[model samples]
Target: EKADGIFILGQNPGTNHPRMLTTLERAKENGAKIVALNPMPESGLMHVVNPNPQEYDNILTYPVKMLLNRGTALNDLWLPVRINGDMPALRGIMKEMLAEEERSPGSVFDREFIERQTVGFEAFVEHLRATDWEDILTGSGLTRDQIRAGAQIAMHCKRIICCWAMGLTQHKNAVATIQEVMNFLLLGGHIGRPGAGPCPVRGHSNVQGDRTMGICEHMSDAFMEKLGREFNFAPPKEHGTDTVETIKHMADGRIRFFLGLGGNFLAAAPDTEYTARALQSCRLTAHVSTKLNRSHLVTGEIALILPCLGRSEIDRQESGEQFVTVEDSMGIINPSRGHLEPASKHLRSEPAIVAGLAKATLANRTTVDWNDLIANYDRIRDHIERVVPGFENFNARVRGEIFYLPNAARDKRQFNNVEGKAKFVISEMDLHKLEPGQYLMMTVRSHDQFNTTIYGLNDRYRGIYNGRRVVFMNPEDVKDAGLEQGQFVDLTSCYREEERVARHFMVAPFNIPRGCTATYFPEANVLVPINSTADRSNTPTSKSVVIRVRPSTRTAEAVNELRRNIDEVRSESASSRSPTRQS
Candidate 1:
């Protein structure tokens, strides 16, 4: 239960979770070893200034920059694994650990826990023993000694927490890679203990909650039965469309109506050009949002922008003012009350909009009281309590500051699997196959932006200023590709005999692994193939794209020609409209 070691993989908590820096700082001060594994070095993991002055400063100051530079050191070891090489790197570490265990026999691994709390240990061990070292070294861009060093850390630590994010999940072998991570944990008996488990940091808030509340296209029969019983309606048993499927359906003219409750789907989705075309193919599209985004600009034939109340704005219903409950990553539900006034008087809450739309669409066909549900939020909560598991007494429990939804795996070492114990999954090592002139490119968010919203042009953490259309490549790769820093190049992705090109992006030499490059999206989303997605998850393979970087050729000339044609057309129109000129 002791938190002696913390391993972060593929996440930059410094920029993403800036507030958690202080917690990490304290954890480090308490002698916790922090190891960060990523393809590119993140500033947050390198160093972070404690925002709270009481921890470092004696006097309180406004603006906070005066005391911003003082904070705790982060990341005792930073492993620059190749893009999509997390599976191999982790396997390498486990291999080294197994080697150590073979030498000393029960010194490195918890054999007792393996026998009691786990199944398939013998098979997993045999697989690990049979794995070739050469393949591991090649898949991971690390030497044997580097992998050994990481293995030594895992072997010595009593408690270890493995954290990862989209970097490890947006690949073809994403599920397998994560299962490998779990295999590593289960081997060392790292899960179900204090300060030791898997922590998958989601990009946004309430993502896990959304899934728990049956927001996914795929719902279990049990959930559907409960929903039908509560609502007195027969729910559809067929599977629904996911993001990729939705795009495909739209492109094929199968889907006509597209309604987005929230999120900038166009900017956040992959294959930007294709996704845009799919959206335009729809007969009608509606978006409920607080502010305008890129998705509003790219629309279908009939588009409606339904401005909704923000989380910070008061929601006045027929009963009285109401509050919405949001669940965090940790399954903790909390009531979110808005103290500020609405941005606009015409804006409606999300619930109100949905209810109104349902009433208009259904007319008198359904027995559901849409207007009554909107009258008071408690009615909605009561309905959710009856339908959704772990949400019993949802209205009453949410009145408190926080309530934790029951998590069997988190609360106890309970795993509802085939063997009733944690299973050791065997996964194949499938790395990206790159050609001579191609590099593996991964899309990342800039420090200046949150997801697709750009707050500023500067990526202050990476020292990039005044731009977002810049690719970060290894210096050696830049030289090998015959490109210089600040040079404009076109990034072209070739997949399934189709090539998509993003034009005129500046190349910046960075400390990434050889043959691997990183670029910020949705600027580079055009290079991602719509068909290239993770198996099972169906998430776009944003972290593993084979792309060729070439110098820009005829794009400038094409733009100049188009501008000249526009000017000539304008001149001709003016001449035709002149008073002295007659037709």
Candidate 2:
């Protein structure tokens, strides 16, 4: 399990995970080659200072500290990939690797491993071999030499880790692109090995845990049967609505009640204006939250705000005190305890609120003991242990530092596919084609924001100050469009014969690829259509949007008025300076 090379795809660790920079720095010092493939250059990947105080003191002057603590350069090679070009770039690398395998048979690929543990390898290889170089170059915005350099690194490394995030997953070809990445790793027998695998970094903490705890609408029949057996009641096996379906239902006036646990749905969801209208169409909307957000302000006919205790606040019940178990990205179950007292006496824990709602709604229809579960969290864990697999002795196992959930692929090198082996998937090369005068746009978060929360207006890492209503564009593209720095423009997105506009945003020149632009959302969420989603995943295609920029009408009118006022002042000054003989 020795890893000598690491490839980061579509993630900006600097702003997203500041603490991970130190880990990357250490990896680089240990003779590991780090390659960063992103659309924009990130500060965290460029250079990172060790945050540990023992490594360097923080009391020194800024310049002195910089010299004394010369940080580690995280990225050895940075590939500025075009927006939504992840699939093409991965295909290009795989194509190069296939060529090398052809030249030196069995040197670049694992023939024995493919034959023994994988299926459909021949078809996958054929697809890569037949990939067009012209499409690769155009879609990836990289030359043949660049792709070859990346393949060479992969060929030389005995073990490698491929990491990706939302950047590659928020597109129409999101699922297909990820399969391509896995195919690249499997070409050299990277699966079921130490330090060699695919790592899809989760955007938020406990997201995987939420899915594991049956938070999704599409739960498997096995899980539902287990849950029904454990709870002594028949559970619904029908698939529930996803985000897109929920929005559509809400818009059609079918969904009467809307309940949100802990999210700024209005700001986070795509097609902000449409989502807002849909929410307004609901009969009643309710939210369980710690603080007020934009969703709270935009409500339905009858709205209710249920104040809940924050994760950091003490959750006290009739029994005494309690703690919640949350699973991390790597399947590590850890108990999270809050040291601080509750912010308000009226605030209730999430579980208590849900239990109260269920007890009131169900009345005497169900046999489930909501009161008992709310009194002690151990009872909930016990039920979970009985219902969910790999969670045996949940209460006892979650007490120590951490406990890992069972992962067959990682532990036993066993694939849980239909054929009981890893399957090599073949996907089509689908690239988003843009029309003339339209640029590929994507929504991004500013440095001062986390998800939908806005802490400040400035993004210091990207050199953006005093603004969130600004679009980042390539300098050459900006100049070619006859636009100047700080010029105001209106962005309009056309999808399914419908147009959505976000007005009056200033342009900032950046180092992004040509015909691509980036803007911060939920401001830009207005431009995203609710209908535009990924094929299989049904995820919002927020990362690859086609939008046109036009000069702002208000800015143009203001400029004209200012020029007329300046001329009037000039004429007045000339008249005042005239001689007495002329008068």
| Shift of residue 225 alpha carbon in model 1, Å | 0.5
Error of 2 at 377 (Å): 1.0
Q: In candidate 1, how many Å is residue 525 off?
A: 0.6
Query: In candidate 1, residue 413 scores what lDDT?
Result: 79
Q: Where does candidate 1 stray beyond 4 Å? A: 54-68, 206-208, 554-583
| Candidate 1 residue-wise lDDT, 466-530, digit = tens | 66678899999999888999887889998879999987777899999999998987888999999
Q: What is the lDDT of residue 15 in candidate 1?
A: 64
Q: Distance from true position, residue 396, model 2, in Å?
A: 1.6
RMSD of each: 7.2, 9.8
TM-score, cand. 2 vs. native: 0.92
Question: Which residue pairs overlap in candidate 2's backbone?
Answer: 1-194
Candidate 2, residue 14: how far the Cα is off, in Å: 1.5
Model 2 C-alpha lDDT per residue in residues 1-583, reported as the tens digit of each score: 2677889997888776666787777778788888888889988778887756665445554456467867777788888889988788888988998998999999999888788888999988788878889999888988888888888888888788898888888898899889888888888888878877887877566345887889888999899988888877888867889998899999999887899988789989999999999999999999988776779988899999998887777889889899998776667888987777676788888899999999999988889999999999999999999988899988888886589888787777689988877888998887667787889998887766667766666688899875677889999989988999989899999887999998878899999999999999777999988999988899998998889998887997645644564465355445433332010
